[model samples]
Target: MALRHFFLILLVVSIWAFNNIAIKWGLLDLPPLMLTTLRFVVVALILVPFTRVNLHQLRYLAVLAFTFGFMHFSLMFISLNNTDAGTAAVIVQLGTPIAMLLAMVILKEKLRLVQLLGIAISLSGVVVLSGSPTIPNWWVLVLMLLSAFGWAISNMIVKKSPPISPLTMTGWLSFLAIPIVGCASWLTESDQITLLVNASWRGWFAILFSAIGSSIVAYSLWYSLLKHYNVNLIMPYSLLTPVLAVIMGVLVLGDSMNGFKVTGSLLVILGTAIAVINLRNLRMHAKLARFRYAGRSKGH
Candidate 1:
């Protein structure tokens, strides 16, 4: 990528990193599931009128809704509600490595030696940080792991499925998720909507930002980069999310920092960098492609 595009990718990473902070702030006064419901509701309301889904591809979309929408957001929301956002962010960083393992086992993608080391590093970080008493009874830990799995599965489905604008995907998933999660909230909790009505303004503000900024705008930018940039270049930048999340949690959300969190955070960043940069050759090709695209546009 050109320096400009690289900087743009960095900007996108920063936005995503802030997403953890944003979501944590939103959950302050809002109930976990209920806040999630509102976030998706806004996303659906905004996106429904604009994008139409391909009915033929409903099967793939259904899978996306189940994994990405219902499971991922529900679990993450519940997890963040119970713990510090920084810790949740660090733990949720497991999704990338877990996805790699799934891709290797089921998709038969072979891992290079360095990639294997990266996996080991990430898993070690997970083991080091997971020794909290809160994890045993903490709904957040289990919920976050489920969210990560949902994300990984959805990623696999998205890889083979016919291309849809991420906007349409997010919208459909958000709309579809409403009833699924609403039913879940109803059955699991006594009444979540009541919590919505009773939530503070700060909570509502957080919900709106999570909907518009994190889910809608951040996702839109990310998929746009996927169109223009290679995954090798883009994926590494995503590691910034949890790092930013931890910083925001401490500086913004008042979560205290400790030695283990700092160490785990470093390991996660280092492992992600090792894995993503392992594709340096592909990244070169992607940069060349971006230049050709830009040159062609200028010629026109």
Candidate 2:
């Protein structure tokens, strides 16, 4: 990669990793479901007007939004509410391998063994991160793993489905998320508005960054990169999430990191680096498919 592209990857990955910290902190003040719902609503409102989509687009948006937006995140926040923040950060990285597996089955993409190893390595980090001298409940482990798969499946859906404008995809999916999560929130969470009103400005800032910066700006940039670059090259850098999460936790959240976190984080980072990176050719092949799809549409 060129020096500039390297930094672009760095910048985007930073945003994503930091978003985990943001979500964790936001949860301090808001219910997980309500906060997620609010974030997507903001993203949806901001992006919806920029692109024009017909009814056909609306249907596609609904599916994507439900799976990626509502279903995936609903599970995630529920899991987050139950698990430790540092541990949750590591667990979601499990999405890397899950995406690779799903991509092979659904998208018919080949997965290199190196990538498989990366997944295992990163996953070991989860094991290390989750259990202490005291083992956490197995239920928590299962829920966190489910959350990881949620994100991975969502990534696959985005990769496999017919291409749309990134903004259109982002906007509609987010907008659609509001009703499902909102109803869930309304039914389960009494005093929703009170929580919104009483939240500290810091919480509000976290919410805004997560809703707008991470979901809209960061995800938009990510989709653009995926549209233009090789995902394998990009996916490894996702390992950075746990790293950044630790930094943010210690620095901003005043969370402590123990020796296990250090060792596991190292293993995860090393595993991801070994498994997935240096895939310029892979990117070319993937985008060629996108180009072909675009061409077929024009001919029709």
TM-score of each: 0.88, 0.81
RMSD of each: 3.8, 7.5
- Per residue, candidate 1 scores C-alpha lDDT tens digits across 189-234 of 6556666677777788777878888778777777887888666657
Writing each residue's lDDT as its tens digit, candidate 2 over 104-185 gives 8888888787777876887787677665422257776777777778778778777656778777887788888889888988
Query: Which 10 consecutive residues of model 1 have the lowest summed lDDT?
Result: 131-140
Report, for every candidate in turn, its global Cα lDDT versus the true structure. 0.77, 0.74
In model 1, the runs with Cα more than 4 Å from the true position are 1-7, 132-139, 282-300
Error of 2 at 145 (Å): 1.8
The clash count of every prediction, one per candidate, is 1, 0
After TM-score superposition, the amount by which residue 91's alpha carbon in candidate 2 deviates from its true location, in angstroms, is 1.3
Model 2 deviation from the true structure expressed as Cα RMSD, one decimal place: 7.5
